[model samples]
Target chain A: MSDSIAIELRDVVKRFGDVVAVDHVNLQIRDGEFFSLLGPSGCGKTSSLRMIAGFELPTSGSIIIHGREMGITPPHQRPVNTVFQSYALFPHMTVAQNVAFGLEMRKTPKNEIARRVQEALDLVRLSGLEERRPRQLSGGQQQRVALARALVNHPEVLLLDEPLGALDQKLRKEMQLELKSLQVRVGITFVFVTHDQEEALTMSDRIAVMNKGKILQVGTPTEIYERPNCRFVADFIGETNFIDGVVIGRDGNYTVLETPEGLRFRGLAARPLSDGTSVTYSIRPEKVRLLTPDGALPPDGLAGTVMSVNYIGSDTRITVRINDRRIIDVWEQNTRSTLDRNEYWQPGEAAVIVCPPDNALVLSE
Target chain B: MATLQQQQQGRDRIRLALLLTPGLLWLVLFFALPLVIIFVYSFMTNDALGRVVYQPTLDNYITVFTQSLYINAYWRSIWTSVLTTVICLLIGYPLAVFIARSPQQWRMPLLMLILIPFWTNFLVRIYAWQIILANNGIINGFLELIGVGRLPLLNNEGATLIGLIYGELPFMVLPLYAAIDRFDFTLMEAAADLGANKIQAFLRIMLPMTMPGIVAGSVLVFIPTLGQFVVSELLGGAKVDYLGNLIQRLFLRANPINWPLGSAMAVLMMIVLLVLIMLYFRATTEEER
Candidate 1:
């Protein structure tokens, strides 16, 4: 199943009355790939997940899973399982019963169902918890039980909708890695939907960045992060400062930008902008360097005044106000200098911020 | 000043205790005391005047045990209440689920429709059913207007059973509606995604998850049905005698001297309902295991 397509969505359009939730989306998820639909709330991510689950049928287009077209095929007949955000475990049944329910539905042999349930529970590290009800377990353990309940069926695809949203930060992080390894161990295609960018970055093999009712970009985490196709994707993925300017010169792969404040800036050339065309340069705050006193190494740097300084463990973040117009954020690695971070930079003190030219992203629109 | 504060604290405790006393006293006097009295009466023998003879005998209980009359009434009441509860559950559970799973704008109106029957008097509703079910009533007229067979919906065992079910339907629906409204529907979707068919999901997931509401609705509909006098009187119309009718006839109509028998019947009915309620609670509790 390595190269086989597990699920395919072609021109899927879903409407709720007059509102269009998913607008003619086309996607193909390969077998064993951990794919994520990352978006903010109400961006049709959950709607797309629901369509694949057969809980909601698309107004048009086809949902093909494992080479079978699911045309209004009820959820029970689908060869896919979902782990819900709330971990909707059965309250009346023990963990073992909950896990065995799917096998019972499929008419598996009683003894075999029992054995398989035990194996699934063991995989989820819930060996001794078979007899406990859902309420007896903590949030994380219940989450695992939900996973075990779904995985016991060994469906071709697994849908997870915000499965880690209810977890605390530490548990969510732990579950992130656990879920990633579990997907690898099971070797099944996973379609995870979440609005958390870091969770997607850490866990997904391919990420689809969705906004509104359309997919803005779909790529590997590195590709999406290092080179976002649009401004929204870049801003949503991580922090970056945008400076609007006009293209002044083009030198093969490098371009010179002139901000309205008359500060000449250098940035990379992606899609070349014509000379004098309005554009924006995105510069990562961490790439900015604060020049020290005494004729520092940088001879050509933007002049500014240190407006504020914040100390965070291993880094000092200083904001430099430029010509009373723009502000550039610079992160300085702490070296435990003689001057305290608070004493080192005060408001209205002259400062210089510098970064390599290639670190800036050029945008035309 | 310290003494004054202490005095205020003492008075506060007194006020709090006073606030709790009325409800406690009501429970003890109206509920707990009556149950204890029934407990004593179940063990004692009564004379013809309905006065306690002060003689310790299980003769009344023995009569209840040996007499086929009392035994049949006891069994019939239980069976009728069971049938009522089951029918209500079969009908109300789905209705509640449909309402709860419906779109947001429709939820409140459908819930109000379920609850509107309860806004007025249940007795009045039973009377209305009487008018609708009686021979040559509006129902029969309509049936004739449509040229259909006449229905025997009153003055029969089946008619009383139907009344029992109808009277208890709302009770069943309200509890079930609460359960369904609070139900996390994602579990059903999860079950479906886990490759369980709709029947399996319903039996193993939905039904068991809604057990508390089912049990609550069952008990609420059952105990009162076992002892209800109005439905049997107005709808059954003396064609058959249920436990409630038998007790009433014994004390008030058949023979004034048979108050002992009525007391005995009341005591026996109480025991039967108590046992039934216990059995239902046990059955529901086992589901948690």
Candidate 2:
């Protein structure tokens, strides 16, 4: 894939009356990259996607697609197509006719339209059902038709706004993988808008995590999960245990934090913080190591009592009460396939919770 | 177990009969009986003393089919109704779309405004149009005040057409509004995203999708206007004689009351309307399938 920017948004802001739907969102989507706009509902992610599709004109700032600034350029003139959230397939047209609509509008020759429509349908694995109307197809089939309809246009970029939101969980999961593969196969810039964090993580080459009309973070999946810059990013992406503390010292890249209860721990911070500054140390439950306190406690580890233990098939979740007040979770892989009670921690048992210094993340906010 | 199943079936039959009784009774009394009477009357003759004679005759039916005046009236009525329907569709489509796409707060008010004409007595509203289109009435008065000569606005085919379209505009607009209102606007956006310009999107996506409403509105206007009497009588001042006016004159105003001829014309009008409606339904249903 080329690294040249396929689409760029410079301080794009969209306001509906007094409510700002999208704040000053500046984005650089590289050519042939599967970029995802990830957030909860009403987080301006879909608004950003709509603006890129030219469905909406920015209230201020400018959007440049392939280096040409799109100012009041209607969606029909833009070199991008959208797979609407509703799957928005033309109900009156057959699947093939719907797929051929764009090329027909462009006055492409009939033979070429037929060839491209077939290829697009086959790409989405919907070759046999070309004659069916949208209502005749299943939800998944309709979604495939929508995908084919948009892809047949061969636009420079493709905008998908929660296209698989209506599908059942099993179908959604299947489509997510299929969509990612399709994007890779087509090699077109895909700006996907989805509220499902896992979907974004699974499909996107890079993700922009947005909140309240603003993008909070943009990075690769690993960077977003491991090095979340703020408390919101940490909580939104995945489950993590937060230990509130004040910075006591710095050890190389790690910030040493001391709890009000006088327990000390070390974690990495996005930026260096002054000593005595209040901070929250975050560490994923899976990163924490649980052991019997009496058996082999790490010298720097905190001691706690196991409040609860849940056996969740592949992993056992152990909630430990530290300093008699704070409850921290520790996830342990169920490596032992045998169903033995002794293999997992029991409630009210003494335990030591420890994590590698690099796995812990410190949030100043 | 056999007795229980039989009793359940009997109870369901009674319940179904109870639910259907009133509607069936109404249709039989009002619709079926009147149609049968009209059909029978079409084959009977009227006496010279303006009284119906209990004599079956083909002469009245022949006169209706053969008379130039009746033929011209039927043709004029059919063409005028067609014109009215087309005009309603052209004007009402955009208006209905505007109302349907309007903000939620404005939608009900706009719809209520369209329905305001229906609240008044139908004749009174047509009478109001008569006054408005009259030479010395509101519109022409305004025109004369604006330094333009008073054009003949009333008692003509043009005035009658305006009246028909004005009276039927709500029928055209309401159904179209209902269909457009229920439409998923996202499809339009999808069309635009698929490289369809505004006109293309409207023609292929919006227009075809809203066809049920168009057919419904057209049928409502066309059927009524074909047999319209009041608009032509009042606005056209009997200058524009349509099938409805001819039937009225034949039954009441002619030197000898021609009940059989009028009844035959009425039956013929009903048959024409039924055929048109059936054809429309067949075309739409086949397209849907």
Candidate 3:
């Protein structure tokens, strides 16, 4: 990705009657970047994509595409294309005609249109079935046609509204990789909107996590998953055990926190927090280690009883109850190939869970 | 003994036959029998006293094809029907799109307004149009009140067209509304996203997708307008003769009424409409390929 911006939204607010679908959203999508707007349904992710596509005009803010103000500029006038979630291929037209519709509308030379249409079809690996109507094609094939139809236009940015959402799980995964590679090959800015976190994390170069019409955080997938700045982003992206606590002082690089029961803990903080500030300490299950409690407890180690041990393939998950009111989950990978029943942690065992300060996060919601 | 499955199959067949008996009998008697009678009569001769002669001849068909009076009526009927169909489509398509795109709470009430005229008798509504369209009627009186002298607002082909369009608009609107309602409007957005303006998107996508509705509405308006005589009679003041008026005269009003000639005309009209409708369906569906 370059330093140049492909699209920018300046304090955009979109309201449908009384409901604010996108509230004061400010975003900058860089050129040649695979950026994703990740959120749950009705979190305004799709609405944000639509705004960039020029489908919905912002009620109170300006949108800039390539430094041009897109104020009341209709979708067609904007230099972007969209692949809708439903594919939305014309049922009447054959695959070739559907792909060539944009070129024809722009009055492109007929011979050039045919050539580009063929190239686009080949890009999506749909060259042999150009004459078939949309109804005759399978779901995956139709999706490819939708993609080709938009890409053939060669817009500055391609907006996709959960384009792979209609496919089965296996096909969705396959398309995610294919789409990511295609974006890299084409080197066009891609603004993808999806509610599936795994799909976003697997494909996006940078993800903007949104909720309730506001963007909570925007960062790389690794940053988003491992160092989520807020409680919502930490919880939404992946599974994490949150322990409510108050900040005590800092130790070296880690911030020390104390729970209500006076149990001390240490974790990294994205921002500096003053002492005595209430916060939530988040640690992923896989980041925690479980050990049999011996003589004295180690620093930041909580002695607890194993509440449940679930041996899912590849990993054994155990919930440890430190006190009567709090339980934290720990996941241990099964590195050993042995299937011995005694190798896994058993319920009612006394265990001490240790959370590394480097892998943990002190999130201020 | 027969197998249980075979016995059930036999019972199902008997039940199916019983269920189909009434509809089959009604169609055979009232629909197919009349068509057969008309076909037979078209080939027969009419005597001097207008009684049917058993001897078969091609005279009625020859007269229908050669006579200027009959040819003129056929052309006039076809022209008027085409005009009505096109106008209804131009007007009804937008109206149906408006209704279909309306808010959920307003749709039912708006559709009800379209259908409210159906509750009254057809003749009663035409008579109301006559009153509203007469030279000294509602429209002319309003014009006169506005200080513009009354214009010739009635007893013309234009008035007849107005009446025909008024009566047939709902037929066009209903089917178009159905097609537009079933249309996925997201395709319009898809088209626009790919660098198509609003007009281009509608022409290249919306219009073609809603074609089934257009074909249905055209047929409904065209066939009825082609056979209609009342609108021309009541509104056109019988200034011109149409195929329906000629057929009505031969069957019921003319001196020494010619039944064979009327049957031949009716048969020819049916043949023409069938060929036209077939060609229309073929032309419209060919675009899908």
Candidate 4:
């Protein structure tokens, strides 16, 4: 592993009896980076995170933290703290007491404990709540307290396991921004786990999408979203309208694909393809635009009707019936939408859907 | 509609009152009325043939405080009970923790082991202690065979204390185990991750978390130890005279004239227990807030 890595799991394996929770996974987290392990439930994301936190030991491999193999360093002795899913604040301690706990454990002087606890609490925007017990606080407040407790320890890494899962959607989004900014301000390595794809994209510096205890792909949010390496990666990240096709041959930087709807489209070569190879491609809904039947298209074209029009204030979502057999979603910005059924179009009326060739992501058939 | 609803509310209140009347009347007639009679007995004088005479005096209580023989016995009994309680807690705490921390698969079987001693009747257990702790009992016989002389164990204060602790240990273990096991284990781990060593985490986090169980267990152990007679009688024979033994003697063995004296003594012990438990509960609630 590189010396620049804060924590690294080398061929780690975890098994719970007959169930292999985490297969042999290898990952290296860079120093002071906000990394997220994104996956659906039962996908081994949390198991991998737990191994890094030392809550669990990898079954068949070593875990290195701070450039040292943590042979048997128990969770308490490790220079890392975790913000649990439920916050797991000490019920008996006041907010101040809870925050001061880590420092006090190291025999920190009483005054120093008080100072650091207050500083950590203020960092999480929870001040003057020192005397309140965990039970007295709201869920979001408790979550903040848990964060402060970990932050006050000044650990090299913070392990957050679905920290915002319990909050309502409004609070979850707000906390997403809060966590992202806090990570930047603190600049400590954070290993977060979540099944919420949007949250992973919004908060993570890099995301490792996991499935069945293995990393499908890991990359920057834009890279993973714009150029998914496989069909699962493309489908899991966001709304992508899949188009089945066959690859004929490659053009210097693109591939010409013949679709099932008797149309040929030119697209960026997602992977090397041979002549006569069957393939599939996907494009985001936002990439497809609704046009008049006479409007021009860049080789890739499908004639369809407006099945259902959802008039969102900022963007209109229309399900377009492509070739009278398939439906491709088209999202139009409210500012650019010029369709008026009474004047130009109506439901079940034929229209043309144009998708730029470069926007199509080649996927496995 | 509103009047009908109000009428039902009134009727429910009446029904609740009626439901409580039987138990409350029974307690007043049997429990409260006996205490009143005992209070009156404590003040009255007994005649030559040990018949009750309707004259009031504070003579028995005064004698209890003024006489060294009675005063020493009272303090000695209290000291032994305290010793028994301390020893029971020392041994029971670790055992309870062991059972509590065991995996779920083993929990029921281990708890059953803790409860199994109670299956053989309580008195039989006390008598079993006699066969082991007596002067020429199994323990002494073993000692003799192992080239040691017979040691004086039974009919001694230490013997009663041991029996008392052995008998009370399970009662202590169950409640403490329940409390410790019910603790949020993740909180302890959180404390550790924050920077606590194992011991500090337990002291600052685990200790305070399971305090309710400790309080309940201590009360349960202490209250019964305050007035245990069978273990004291079987192990100490006639020499061990705890409050329970005193109560028993007044009713079944002691001079009949001294019945009122023993009743007064029993009432005093009951008052002491009530006050101690009340103080304990107050302290716990204050700490909770």
**CA lDDT of each candidate?**
0.85, 0.90, 0.93, 0.83
Q: Tens-digit lDDT track for model 2 on A1-365?
A: 78899999999999999999999998899999999999999999988888888888899999999999999999999999989899898888899999999999999999999999999998999999989999999999999998999999899999999998999999999999999999999999999999898998999999999999999999998888888988988999999998899999999888899988888889898888999899999999999887766765675577889999999999999899987678889888888898789877889898888878889988997
Evaluated on CA atoms against the true complex, candidate 1 attains a DockQ of: 0.66
- Runs of candidate 1 exceeding 4 Å displacement: A1-4, A275-277, A292-300, A335-349, B1-21, B31-69, B103-109, B118-123, B149-152
TM-score of chain B of each: 0.87, 0.95, 0.96, 0.90
Which candidate achieves the best lDDT against the true structure? 3
Candidate 3 CAPRI grade = high
- Per-residue lDDT tens digits for candidate 4, residues A120-148, read 99999999899999999999999999999
Q: Find the candidate with the highest TM-score and give its number.
A: 3
Candidate 2 vs. true structure, TM-score? 0.96
Candidate 2: docking tier: high
lDDT (Cα, 0-100) at B170 in candidate 4: 86
Residue A349 local lDDT, model 4: 73
Ranked candidates, highest lDDT first: 3, 2, 1, 4
Every model: Cα RMSD to truth: 3.8, 1.9, 1.7, 3.5
Candidate 4 — which residues are off by over 4 angstroms? A1-3, A243-246, A256-266, A275-280, A295-298, A323-325, A336-346, B1-12, B94-120, B128-159, B236-239, B278-286
Return the lDDT, model 1, position A221: 96
Displacement of residue A339 (Cα, Å) in model 3 is 1.3
For each candidate, report its DockQ versus the true two-chain complex: 0.66, 0.82, 0.86, 0.66
